[model samples]
Target: MLTLLHTADWHLGAQLQGWPREAEHRKALRALVALAAERRVDAVIVAGDIFDSLNPSAEAQKLLYDTLKELRAALPAATIVLLAGNHDPAGRIEAPRALFDLVNVAGVGTIARKDGEIDAGVHLLPLRGAGGAIEAHLLAAPYPRAADLPILDGASEGSPVVRSVRALYAELIAAARARIGAAPLVVTGHLHVAGGLESEGAERRILVGGEHAVPSDVFPEDIAYVALGHLHRPQSVGRECVRYSGSLFPLSKTEIDYNHGVTIVAIEGAATTIEHVPLPRPTPCLRIPPRGGLARENVEAALAALGLGPATPADDKPFVHLTVAADGPIVGLDAEIDAIAEKFPIRLASLTVERPPRRETEAPAPAALRLSERQPVELFREAFALTHKSEPTSEHMTLFHAAAAEE
Candidate 1:
């Protein structure tokens, strides 16, 4: 039985912007390694996006190296294949391929041309790098740039650009099939295959009828499975054999709905069975908007609704955004805001203070009273004061004071 653990979009060293979810990311990586070891699969395929940024910090690089080392050691017999995703710089990912090779780990990025037929009872063809000739049952197609394909001589039916790119991709797929001969194959790629899941900020919309859409039929009839990447959501492309493993971690809020995990394919002879092994729960975030009249109570109610209760130092807090209206007279408003800020692990993105419409019966309050009533502006002023206290530069203070005056 040839069992392979298919996982993609590790996105190691990714920061949740200002969100404090770094610990979850670290836990997920460690869990992945453990999963590989526990499954005892023949190989573990990391489809791409190993690093969050091309210019990763030293700590990020070390974390990745250590994870790779642990996986390799834990699964000594398994082949760990790492493919380069769009986020990863091709040259940088390929640089450490050889170093990992010394320890039974195989890395295939944009630059490495590791193509050939491996006859381990079953004919396994590994195709890496841009475009290459394959003569095996399985063909692995890496990230191919638009310019890498052969140019089309004549445009067929539709727009010139669209038709030409389509023809080129068709030719490329055909070439791959012809080279593989009659062996039952599995073609893998890092491109956006058709019929894949797309969440917000997960996939950039492909131009209508662009070359990005590689039809599901491109794979030869003999091919059993097509493992793909690039898209962060895990899904199949029409055919059962063709699938995307998706990213290992939730990169954005859009990915909250997606169950982060890897696909496990069990192949015995000609038949294949697929199963998804889910990852741990991700960090949660809550956004609350308090009602106008009861500002303090509303704030407390929002916190309670999130199950956060009164915040403590030890409690791991969710990223919280509070919105409230503060036109009514409220006691200790500043102190309440400060208390919430200090007590809970909350990030105040915006605090909008809505004012009630003018009433003929109600007399206008004094300017001092009006100033005290404006909570959002006061929040801004408080933020400014906190910021200025640390820096304490004349120019910064002037800017803060000007902003405070406007508030």
Candidate 2:
């Protein structure tokens, strides 16, 4: 049996509303190291989005390097593969290939070509078991870029980009099959697949140009398993063998309820079994009123009911999103809420005010404004007219001027 761990979307060095998430990342990496050691897997595949930014901080790079060293030490015989996602700098991820090879680490940031044809050697790696014999073949594919895809002779049926993406994978898979004969082929991708659930505001749209999603049929039936990334939620797309292990932790308000974890894949002969091993959430994400918005007058009570007190350690404090009902514009509301939050140990990430729906007696909605006629002041005026049914007061214009100046 060939046992492997599949994980992705680390997004290291990410911050939530100005709060650094290094502490949470550290905890997740530690747990991952422990899990790999405990499972004694033959390989570990990190699909993509290793870092939140293309140019990661020195501290973020240090965390990644340290974790790689730990994983290598714990699983000396296992192969560790890393692929670059849309969020990662393709060249930067593979820049340290020389050093990575010393510890049995393989990474693919971009596709390579030789003599105008895809280079198979650079993308294929043989998985060796304890006996030092090849078990399965792993095709380390990364996020496809426009430059990496083949130029078709004529316009294809669906979106050109989608067709190119499918072509790219098909070519790579064919190359792998030709080279390895019929050995169980495992593949890695960092694009959004059709039918995969996405966390809004967390994952970026990667399928660029014409279509935003690539059909899961891109992978052939002969493949043993397909490890994917670029989505924050753990899910199987089209088939049971194709899966996304999901992010190590919640990265945004929309991702708070995700079962953040890694995946375990065991392939024996012709049978394959998959399992999800969830990681612990270090800090809690709390909504002030849980279900709905609370009235402005009761907002303080709702916050207090969370059992929060004075500020705790920055890393330990829970992140809170507060929503309060507004009968009309409340005077000094932000200042009042900030004051109330000062008495709690949580991090107030966002504040939203819910207004009652417009009555039927109000004027009908305004016609759509042309994009060419969009001046900052004119757009603001249109928005204010729609909401208040009146022109902006001089005072409102002054505030708008101040805000616009900052922008």
lDDT (C-alpha, whole model) for all candidates: 0.61, 0.88
For model 1, what is the C-alpha lDDT against the true structure? 0.61
Q: Candidate 2 — number of clashing residue pairs? A: 0
Segments in model 1 whose C-alpha atoms lie over 4 Å from true places: 20-22, 111-138, 158-180, 205-212, 285-299, 305-316, 320-342, 346-407
Clashing pairs in model 2? Answer: none
Candidate 2 per-residue lDDT, tens place, 1-407, comes to 88899999999889989989999899989999999899999999999999999998999989988999999999999999999998888887899999888888988999988887778988999987666778898999998877888777786578888888888998999888889998988999999999999898777787767476999999988889999999999999999999999999888888888899999999876778999999988788877677668887897788777775565677898999888877554568899999988887888888888777789997777678787978899889877866555678899999999999999
Error of 1 at 242 (Å): 1.6
lDDT, model 2? 0.88
TM-score of each: 0.68, 0.89
At residue 276, candidate 1 shows an lDDT of 80
Q: Could you tell me which residue pairs clash in candidate 1?
A: 137-185
Give the winner by lDDT: 2
Query: For each candidate, C-alpha RMSD in Å?
Result: 10.1, 4.2
Model 2 stretches with alpha carbons more than 4 Å out: 309-311, 359-363, 366-407
- Name the candidate that leads on TM-score: 2
RMSD of 1: 10.1
- Give me the displacement of residue 389 in model 2, in angstroms: 9.6
